[model samples]
Target chain A: MTIKILGTGCPKCKQTVDIVNKAVAKLGADIKVEKVEDIIKIMEYNVISTPVVVVDESVKIKGRVPTMSEITALIQAS
Target chain B: MFDWLIYFSDWLIYDVSGLSEGSRLGTALSFFVYDVIKILILLFLISFIMGIVNVYFPVEKLRNYLNSRKLYGLEYLFSAIFGAITPFCSCSSVPLFIGFVQGGIPLGVTFSFLITSPLVNEIALALFLGMFGWKVTLIYAITGILLGTFGGFILGKLDLKDWLTDWVKDIMAKTYEKGDTVTADSINFIKELPLISREAWHIVKGVLLYIIIGIGIGAAMHGYVPENFFEQYLGGGQWWTVPAAVIIAVPMYANAAAIVPVIQVLVVKGVPLGTAIAFMMSTVGLSLPEATLLKKVMTFKLISVFFLVVTVFIVASGYLFNLVL
Candidate 1:
């Protein structure tokens, strides 16, 4: 599964990247995590806020950093 | 409402710490303790409530709503009000600004959101309510909303579309003219409580240091500064003080949480209430970093014009406040 994180490189966005990585590692999931920082690409997602976590091109989180457990639950569900 | 906090502060300072009542150090510490506790409690509660509201009324939904209809100039007011409730870090403002413009929201309406987002928010509201009471808080809130509304209206009327950088103009040309439908996920309130609480606590954690520093400065001024210390310079009669305060504040940047408590002390130390409010508004609303970020989409001319318009409104509000309050 591919998880794309979209943001404009703000601190929260960077932190979201770290948390998502840790969540993936903790869950022992072989997920491909990608960070999308380009504004034009981010706009394609139709979200005004960031950092957004997209699982298979579907938005799961936007505008806030998700906690570890929440990320795990999301990964598990997906 | 917080008499118990006052009593506890008094006991802690006088009985526990053995500081004599009414002494400078004693008074300062006591004031600090009382204000810190009161403001913290208020911040947590208000943020929690606002978090719930945000969960229900998501920003994407609001953006779509704004984009779908023309509010007959009430859009400016709605934008300003929307900006007040939706919180995001100022660093992320560029993307959001671009998104609004790309979504076909008017540049002027987006300006309203940008102007008031930082100047007035739940943290500022809670701090103001805790320190200045409801009357001042209500006046401040109303004035902030009006400042954004009128400032944005004037900017919108100017038709500064050509002033945008070519990059933004390019995007504007290509993108569709309205916001797309945003699907909001449905979750029961009980199931969302943890997320809401986390968000609220996250906000509180983010601003806790600013609150402390702000209230610490306030306490120091409260205890040690002689009466009329700032009155000599920023007194109500001085016509230049209002504009001067706004100008001085424009370049410096601090969140409203840090500035509000200090503003409370400034008013107490004989700075005119209007002048202090102007300073707070300018400091939070306009900043060098934000200007730098806007350089992405706006030319230097547009940025300067944006700053000048907002500054004038803030200065005018300062004078109006001085006259009325």
Candidate 2:
């Protein structure tokens, strides 16, 4: 599984990344977490909001500063 | 007052002449070069400082404390002062605003902080004093504080307290956990300064256009704005001019440091310094974008009250300036 966090280096994006990391850890998932900070590439994923969580090529969440549990559930379910 | 005009006219011609000297292209190049240098330096300093504050300051604790009480009157005054210290811009300030409402801080008090936080501050005051003079800076500071205080107070009194968006309240209930106060482990202050300085430079570079636009507007106002318009319309002689100025300022967004040059021009051009200041304060403090951002968290009535209270204070300050200054 691949988890990607998209943002422009804002605190909220960072928080999302952190949450996703912990969630992946707890789930013991074979996931590679990637962070994308480039604005153009983020838009390519059809996301207009920063701090987006993308699983594989599909967007899981956009424009929110999500919590740890939320990220965990979303990741495990994915 | 009339005598001051002759002196101002003489000064204006002197500045314009200096700007116009040399081949037109050469002069324009030099002006752009100088502007770029200055803006780069200023922006770097401001953003770096803001970054340092973001990284180190106890912002969350203070924000939480401010929201913990419904001390509307004193909170307004506190919010004005506190807003100056917090480095949140129009965009970055929203999440904290969500934090404010979640902590049960009154809408009016939060608005006070929101109004003052963007419009006036130490960095801006320093720049104003450096570019203009202390007297103008003093007037700007006083007016800014008055706007925040009175705006908050009046908004608190409005009966539309329950007008916040349901999503805001719902979101607060779900994910409003506090961050750990582990700032001691963060980078040391001395080490952070250089990093902050660099970022501030970046910001200055990015927003140089805002400064130029502000000054360019001032230059035109100085050169134009018709000498008799102020006395005929917005001067101390007119009662409605104060509110009119406030209304005019709302739709526009003018950064406080950038607006000084224009305010100076408007003041010299026979626009009552008070009315001009009111216009400046209103635009800077209660900008349309800022209000729109608030809409994400607040309902329409609360937002309307936010605008109205700030406008009332700005108009009052305009009248006050005419009487005092």
TM-score of chain A of 2: 0.90
Alpha carbon deviation, residue B39, candidate 2 (Å): 7.1
Expressed as tens digits, the lDDT of each residue in B48-139 for candidate 1 is 88778778877767777889997899999998988887775776687788888887889999989888887787787889899989898888
Cand 1, B chain, TM: 0.93
Tens-place lDDT digits, model 2, residues B109-189 = 777777787767544654455444669878788668767777766676784557878776665566445533433465677
First chain TM-score for all predictions: 0.97, 0.90
* Residue B233 shift from truth in candidate 2, angstroms: 5.5
Per-candidate DockQ vs. reference = 0.54, 0.06
User: Which residue pairs in candidate 2 collide?
Assistant: B43-B200, B43-B201, B43-B204, B44-B200, B44-B201, B47-B200, B48-B196, B48-B200
Error of 2 at A50 (Å): 9.7
Question: Fraction of reference contacts reproduced per prediction?
Answer: 0.41, 0.00
Question: Which 10 consecutive residues of model 1 chain B have the lowest summed lDDT?
Answer: B176-185
